[model samples]
Target chain A: MIATETALALQAPQLMTTPPLLTMTGVSRRYGDVVALQDVSAMVYPGEVLGIVGESGSGKSTLLRMMNLEDTPDTGDYRLALPDLPGNLFDLDRFARRMLCATRIGIVYQNPHVGLLMQHTSSGNVAERLLIAGERSFAALRGRAREALDASEFPLERMDARPIELSGGMQQRVQLAKAIALEPVLLLLDEPTTGLDVSVQALVLDTLKRLQRDRAITMVIVSHDLGVIRTMADRVMVMRRGRVVEQGLADQIFQDPQHDYTQQLVHAKL
Target chain B: MTLASLTKPWEAMSYGFLDASAKRELRRKMLKAIAVPGCQMPYASREVPMARGWGTGGLQVTLTLLKPSSVVKVIDQGADDSVNAASIRSFLSKVSGATETWDTTEATILQSRHRIPEERLRADQVLVLQVPNPEPLRPVEPNMSVARQMHADADYGRLWLILYEQIVRSGRVMQGAAYPSLVNGRHVMTPSPIPRWDVPKLHMAQHLTFLSAGREKRLYAVPPFTRVEPLVFSDVPYQVEDHAALTCHRSGVSGYFMNEIPQDDGSSAFEVSDSHLGIKTIRQAEGAAIRIGPTWYENGKMPQ
Candidate 1:
C-alpha cells in the first residue's frame, strides 16, 4: 500500500514542486460539435480527493473520464507527473498508454455495475487486472488475489462466488480489491458510493481510506455527495457546466463562502 | 466440410495474416482447448513484425480467429504498448483493418500477455492468453504419459504436497505469478503467467478465456461457467496480496498492484504492475489534457 500523504509531499524540481499528480491547463474537450469541457483547468494534487460535483449534464463524468485515457481531449494539454517518476504520462505511445491505464490507474464508475463484469466471481473481478498484467503463474495470481480479498475484508468463501451472488456493497468491495490489487497511482472514482446503502458505503469508504493512507495514492472523486467528499477529499473542485466554479480545501469549502454556486450546493446538501 | 471447399483464397496477402491451414488448425485446437478446460496446445506461431515474448499467443489467436470487421486489442503484459504489443497492433491494422482499443469493454478479441485488462472482460469479449508453457504437468513430472495419466485421473496430489510445504516453512504461499489452478474442479491447469491478482478474475468469466502456447505445443480453455480453482491447502488456507501501499502517482490509484522500478537512489519508482498501456485510458481521459498544458506527447517521445 502506498502512503498517500508521503507521496503527496515528494518534491520534484522539474514539476515546480507541485503536489498535483495530474494538472490540467485550459483544457477543453469537444465531441464533434458538443463541447464537454470548456477551458477547464485544475490540478489533482496528491493525497487530495478533488471532488468534482454537479448535477447531471454538468460534465462531471466526462471530466473524470478524461483523466482515464478512455477519452482524448481535442484541445489543451494534460500533464500527469507520476508522483515519484521523472517522466509525465503523455510521454507514452498508444500501447504504452493503455498498459499504464490498466495497471497504474483505477477507475470506479457511478454505477458499480459499470465497474465490474457481472459474469465473473468476486475473486475473478478482483483478480482480472493481475492476470492481464501477465502474471500467468497460477500460484502467484491466486496468492496475491486472495491477499487483496483479505485486505478488502471480503469473505474467503466469496472468492469463488460470482458478482450476481454478492450484495451491492460486496461487489463494490470486490471492485475496490481489484483496483487496490493493481496498486494504481491514481484512483478515478465516478460516484463510488452513490448506489451503495449507508452502512455499505461506510465500509467501502473506510476500506478506501485505509488503502489510501497505506498506499499514498492520489484520488480524484467525482460525486454530488458532499459528505463523501468531506470525509475523503483534502481539496475539492466543484464543477458547473464543465467548468470549475469553486476550488479549495475541503474544510474551507464547507465553512467559507467563496462562490455562490458552491454555497448553494453546500446549502442544498445540508 | 472438404479441405478444398474450406481453403479460401485471399485477395490481399497481408503480413501476419494466418493462411487457411493455420486458421483451421487454430480453430480446431481452440475447440479442443475449450472442451478440455485449462488445457494448452501449441499453435503455429506466426512471425509478426513485433519480437517474440510480447503477445505471440494473442496475435496468433487474433490472426486465426479474427473476422474482417473484428475489433481487436493487443495488450502486452496487460497494456497495449510495449514493442511487442505495438507491433501486433500494427500487424492487425494492416492485415485485417480491425479497430484496436485499450478499453476492455470495447474490445471483441483481446490478446493479452501476463496481466489481464484492469476492466472486467464481458461475454462479448474473447480473451486469448499468451502462454509460455502450457502443460500444467510440466512443472511436476517430465513424463508426458504420466502427466497425461495424472490429468485424466484428476490427480493433483503433488499440488497438495507443494501447498503443505509452503505452510510448513513460509506459513504462506510465497509464490507471485503463474499460479496453477483446477479447471472445473477436475483438471489441474495453469492460468498462464498473469499475476495472482488476476487469477480470481477468471473465475467464471463471461467471456471465453483461451490459452495458447506458441513455443510449446499446447492450447487450453476455461469455458464460461467452468470452475478454475487455485491450488491451496485447507489448513493454511489461501492468502491474496494487497498493496499494503496501493498507489500510482501518475494514475492516482491506490489499492492496485504496482511494479516497483528501483531507481539509482534506492527508492522504488511505482508503475502499474500491469504493462503501461492499460493506463493509457486514464492518461487520455477528458481532464488529462490539463496535465501537459498543450503538448502532444505520444509513445514517450514528444512530436518535434
Candidate 2:
C-alpha cells in the first residue's frame, strides 16, 4: 500500500515546478469595527502543508475559512488557481461556490461534533459527501465508503456505529474519513486536535500525516500548538493581532527566528 | 316572509357543488400553475360538502373539470371500493352527471389519494393527486412566506441536509413516501404522499399531473413531458419498497407494487396495490374480454 501511494505521489523535482493551488494578497475583513483580519497574505502550493499558528482571535480561522471559500476577503486578490476554473473564486456566484464546496474542498473543525453528524453511522457520514457529489451506484458507494473508513483505521465491525456512541478519538476519526472521502483537492483543518487527550491526539495526528502523504493532498491547518505545526507543517506562518509576524521553512522558523513575536513563540514552545 | 320565500324558485345546489364563478377562478389559477411547472399557485378553495384535508383539493379540481360526458375515476390508496373513494366517486357523478370508472384507461380525469395507478395513463388522461402538504421546504422552514422566498431563489440545497441526517443515522435515506423531487429543474416539489414506487411514473410522463391542497390553498402542476426528478445523492439512488418479485396472492400477477399482509404463520402474503388491475387480470383469466393497458414497469423493472 505504501509502495503504491509513494509511486502515485511521485515526489520529484516536478512538485517544485507545479503552481500554487491557492494564492491571496492583502486580504482584510472586519465586523462592525472589530478587525478579525487585516491585510493577511499567503500562498498554498500542491503536495504541501501550510501551518498558521496563533493565539485566539488572531484571524487564523478566518484565513482558513477564506481558503476553503466559506468566507470572502473584504480587500484582497484571492485566486483559486484550479486549471479548469478562471478568474477569482470570490467572484463566483452562490451556486458555483456551493458546487466547489461539495466537490473540491474539505474542512475539519476543532470540535469533532461540529464537523461530523453525531447521529450518523461512521460510513454514512463519509458516504453523505460522496452522494452530494453525485455518486449513484450502490456498489460503488458502498465500496468507496468502506475504503475510506478502512483508510482512517475505523473498526470495520463498528461501521454502523454512530459517532455519539464512539469515543472522542473515534469521533475525530470519523471526521477525517468524511473530509478525505471526496478526495478533495484542498483540505482545511481548524484546530483539529485541540481538545483530545495527548495519547489519542498522537494517534489521530499519525493517521492525518499518513493520509496527507499518501493522497498528495494540499492542506492548510490552523492551530496554536507549535509541536503540531512542526510535526505536520512543511512551511509555517506565525500570526499575532491579525497579521503574519513571520513565515518560512519550519526548521528555519524554529531554529532562527527573525521577528520578536516569532522568537517569543518559539522560545515559549521550549 | 313565508309567502315571498315560497313564491321564489326552489333550488337545491349549484352545478358541480362549486358556483360557476368559483370554477372560473380555479381555472385561472390552474392555468397559471401549469404555465410554470411545479410552482404552486394559490387559489380560493371553496367549501365543499365533504370536510377539508380529505382529498378536498382533488375533489375541487375534478369538480371544475367535470362535464356531462367526462369519465372520472377515483381511488383512495389504489382501492376503488374503499369508503372514501366510493363516496367521492359517487358524489362527483351525482353533482356533474359524469360517468364513473374504476379502470385507468377508461377515465379522462383520475382523482387519487396516496397512490398512483399501476397501469400507464394515456396522454389524454389527467391525474389529480390530493396533496396533504405542497411545500417541500416546510420541514426546514416553517414560515410559509420564507419558504416561498426560498423557492423563488431556488435555494433548496438545504433540503439535502434532511436526507443527510437520515443517511448518517441509518446508512440509507429512510423517507418512504412524499419524496421531495425537482420538477422542470427549477422547483423542488413533494410528489404528494405517493409511495416511492409510484414516483418514477411521473417523470417526463406523457400524462399531466396536478397536486392540490384545499386546506393549504395551494395547487401545483407537473405538466406533460416535464422532468420530475427525485432529490437524491448520485451515489445513494432512490429506492422503492421491495415488491417487484413477489406475486399477488389472488390474481397471481407478478412484477408490480404489492401490499404485504402478514399471516398467522411466520410468513407474509402479497397483494397488488392497484385493486382494479388485479380485478382486470382475474377477469381476463376467467375468459372475460378485458384489455389491460401497458404498465409503467415490465417484468419487475421500469424500462429505461
Candidate 3:
C-alpha cells in the first residue's frame, strides 16, 4: 500500500507539467471605432490560476469576456484543448457557444447580485445550472446543490434564503457555490472581491484557494488589486490601453516588472 | 425618412388590433417565456384600448395568439357575464373576426382574472391569466431590485417564513388568494391571484398557461406537464376554501366554487360562481341537450 501511495504521489507533479488547456493568438475585439482588446495573446494550463491585472477600461474585462465566449473577438484564434474535443471555440456558432457556456464554462460576475438569481433559493440557484445541463431528477439536482454548497462552507440551514436577505459576503459565496455546482472545466471570475469587506475578502479568497486546489479546476481571475493577484495567481498578466504589456510568473512579475506601466502598478500597490 | 419608407397603404385596422411589429415582439417573448417555465421574461407592454390595469396584459397575449378561427373565452372571477369579461370578449371578437365563447369546452384560448375555469383544460388550449402583481417576493422585500436579485439567487426562505408565521397566527394558512407556488420546482411565481383550488390545476396540467402583468411589464408561462407545487410544509397540507359541499340555489349544481348572496332576513343563498356553467346546467335541466364537460374537481373533491 505504501508503494502504491508513493507512486501516485510521484505521478501528481508529472500531471502538472502537461500541455496548456487554452491558448489564444492575436485576439482582437473592437466596438465600432473603439478597440476593447487588441492583439491580446495568452495561455492557461490545466489546474492553474491565471490572474489578469489592469486599471478600469484597460480591456481586462473585454479579454475575459472573449475567453468566456460572452463576446466574440473580431479577429483571433481561441483553442480550448479538451480531452476529446480540442477545437477553436470562436469558430462555433452562437448556439454552440451557449451550449459550451452551459456545459464547459462557469463564470462568476464581479457583482454577486448579477451572478445570482435573487428570487431563487440558494439551492434553487445552484439547481438551475444543473437543470440547464440537462439534469431532470429533483433528487439529483438537490443532492448536487447541497454538495457544492457544503464544499463552499455555506450555511446548510440558510440554503433556502434569497440573495437579498444574505450579506454581501454570503451572496458572493452563493455565487461561488452556484458556479462550481456544474463542475465546469474552466471557471472565470471578474472582480470577485472588489466590493467585499477586508475580513470577508480574506475568507472568500481562502475559500477560492481551497476550491481551486481541491477540485484541480483551471481558472482565469480578473482583478485590479495586486494583493488578490499575489495571493491567488500562479501566473500574472498586465494590461494597459487594451493591449498586453507584460506577462510572467507571479513572483517574477511582482519582483521584476518589465514594462513601465507594470512597474508603476507594482509600486502603486506597494 | 421619406413618406414611402415611413408609411404604408392604410387598411381598416391591423389584424388582432396590434401592429405586425408588436405581434412579432410578443411572439419572440412568449417563446422565451415558454422555454423557461415560470421565470418572468421582460417585454415591452404595448398599448391596447383597455386601461392599463384592466386585463391589458392578457389582452396583449390573446391578441398576439389570436387567429380568425380561434374561439376565445374571457372570465372575470369565474363569471363570463361580468362587465369586464363581456367587454373584453366582445372586443377580441370584433377586432380579430374570431368567435366568442362562454363554454370552457369550446374555447381555444381562455383569458381569466382571479380564477381558472372549473372544467379541466385540454392539451390544445392556452390559458392567459391577468396578473396584477408579478413579483412573489414583493411582500417580503419591497425593493424591486433586491427582489430581482433574490429571484436570481433562488432564495425563498422569507416566503416560507411568512407562511409559517401565518399558520402560527391564524391556526391555518390564511393566504386566501394568489398563493405563491414554485413552478417547475425552480421559480416561485405568483399564480396571478388564483384561488388555492385553481392553483393545483396548473400542476402537471394538459394545457399551457401564460401569466402576464402589463403594468409590471413581465410575463411567465407554465408549459404542459410542468410541476407547479404550492409552498407548504409537510405537516400542513394546502387547504382550499370549503365550498365543495354547498349546492347552488338556482342551478342546483353542487361540488364547485360558489358565490354567496346574503338575504335581508339574515340568511345566505349560494349560487354557482361560473355563470356560464350554471346557465348550461339550467339549459340541460330544461332539456336543451347541452353538454357539460369534465371538470377539474369531481364530486366536490380534487383528486390527489
Candidate 4:
C-alpha cells in the first residue's frame, strides 16, 4: 500500500466519524444558450484526491471554477463542513467569499503563465499570495516562500529569478509553490500536466503526490488524461458534456467501466 | 439636461488642481505601488498647466495628496529659489491653498528634482521625485516591450554587462547622476538623477518616496524600511563623488556636496549644493537663531 493509504488506514476510525469536507448538490450553470454543468452532485471527503476526467468541452474546467468561486453556478447548494467553518459556503457574502478565496482555497491553472505572475520573481509570486493573506514581515514571507519552493523541488538559487527566465516545467513548479505556500484547506488543479513534457510531467506529479501526502489536503484534480487520474486519484468521476457519466473507485473505473463513454475512454487508453 | 444640472457651482478651481476622478485613480495606483515596493505601477498621467517634462509628474502626485493644511516644499537641484522650483511651489499653494515652506522639517510633502533634501526627513513626510527616465533597462534594451519582458524575466545580465564594460573602459563605473540601484532587492530603478551622494540617503529611509515619470506614465514607490542598494561588484567597492574635502566658499561648511564655480583667474570656488543649508549656515553665523535639523551626512560622511 502507498503512504497515503497507510496513513488513511491508521486514521480509518476517525475518518468515519468526521463529515465530508465539501458537498455540492444540484449544481447547474449556463452561459447564454450553452450549458456548462447540469444537476451535478458530488462530495469530497477529507484527505483524498477526487479526479474528474472528461473530453475537451466536458464542463470539467467549469466545475473546478465553480468550486474555486472563480465562476458562480446558476443554482446549487455548496457546503464546506470543516470544523472551524460554520453554515453553507455558498451563502457567504461577497467579502466573505473573497476572504475564503484568498486564504482557504488554492488553485493551479493549466497554463503556468496564467497561474504565475510573469514579471514577478518566483519568491515574489509566492509571497504575493501570502501578503494578500496578511503576512507582513518580509523575513517571514521570504522564509515561507523559500520553504514552499523547496517542497516543490524548485532550485533555491533561482527563487529570486522572474518567471520569464524559467522554463515551462520550472514555471509550473513555481506555480505549485505559489499555490501551496498558504497551506490552504482545499486545492483545485485544472489540467496541471497537460502541456508539460513526459519526464517533466512525471516529476511534477511526484512532487504533487508527495506534497498531498505530507499535508493530507483535500483536492479536486481535473484532467482529460485517464493516466493522470489513475496515478493521482483515489476516487474517479468521469464527466461527458455537462453530466457525470460514471463515478467509482479508481481501480473499478479503470478495470470495469459501466458507462459507454467511460468504456470507450478506457479502450482508447488500452 | 438643464443648465443648472449641468453645472453645480461656479468654483474658481478644483481642489488640489486635479478632478475628483483623477485623484481617486491616483490614490488607488499609489496604494498598489506601496503594496508592491519597487514594482512600477502604470497610471493615467493627468494634464497640468506645466509642460510634460518640467516636474509635471511630481506636480500630479503633490496635487493628488494635497490638502489645505499641507505644507509643500519644491526644490530643483537642491535650491528652492530656482525658477522651476519657485514656479511649482507657488502654483501648488495657489491651487490647493496650502502653506509653502523652504524648511525641510516643516514640509509635509517635498517634491524635488535631481536632489534629495540635505536634512533627514521625518516619517510623516512624503518625497516625490520627478523622473525623466524610469526604466533602468533602457540603456541595455531600447525597445520598451522587450525591456518589459526582460523585467518580467528578471533578466538583468545585460545591465551588469554595461557596468562591467564601463569599468573596463574607465577603470571605474562612469555613471554620474540617476545611478541605477536595486529597490527591495527585486526591481532595479534609476533613482531619478539624484547624485550618487544622495542615493545613500534613500536606503532604509523613514519617509515614503514616489518616483513618477510624466511622459512615461509610470510610477513606482520605495516604502519606508525598504532596501535600496546600489549595484556594485564586491571586488570594486561603490564610491561616491569626492566632495567630502571641498568646503563651501560662502557658508564655510566642509564635507557636504558642493557646486564648483569657475573664477576669472584659474581657481574654483565651491558653494553648497543645497542652497537652504547654506542659507541656514550663513544665518547661524550672523547670530540669527536658525534651527537646522539633523542631516543625513555628518561631517562629510554618512553614519554607519
TM-score of each predicted structure versus truth: 0.47, 0.77, 0.64, 0.62
Highest lDDT: give the candidate number: 3
The DockQ leader among the candidates is 2
Docking class of 1: incorrect
lDDT of each: 0.71, 0.85, 0.86, 0.85
Instruction: Report the error of model 4 at residue B74, Å.
Output: 4.2
What is candidate 1's CA lDDT for residue A120?
53
TM-score of chain A of each: 0.87, 0.91, 0.92, 0.92
For the second chain, the TM-scores of the candidates in order are 0.82, 0.95, 0.96, 0.96
- Clashes counted in candidate 1 amount to 146
lDDT of 1 by residue, A83-148 (tens): 443554445556566667778888877666777757555665665577556454446666887898
Q: How many collisions between residues are there in candidate 3?
A: 18
Predicted structure 1, TM vs. truth: 0.47
DockQ values per model? 0.01, 0.15, 0.03, 0.02
lDDT by residue for model 2 (A1-270), tens: 122222322223243677778778778899778888887778788889989998899999988888777888788767777777767888887768867877888888888877776765677678767766767555566678789888888887888788899988888788878888888888898998888999998988898899988998899989999989999999888887887777777888899987788898889999
The reply for model 1, stretches above 4 Å from the true place, is: A1-270, B1-16, B41-54, B274-304
Q: What shift in Å separates residue B291 of candidate 1 from its native position after superposition?
A: 18
Candidate 2, residue A250: Cα displacement in angstroms equals 3.0
Residue A126 shift from truth in candidate 2, angstroms:
1.9
lDDT by residue (tens digit), candidate 4, A1-270: 123322321233233566778787778899999998988877788888989999998899999888888777888878787566676677776656766876888889998877876765778778767765656444566688899999989999998788899987899889888888988888889998998889999999998899899999898999998889999998888887888777877898899988888899999998
Which 10 residues in a row give candidate 1 chain B its minimum summed lDDT?
B293-302
Give Cα distance to truth, residue A55, candidate 1, Å.
95
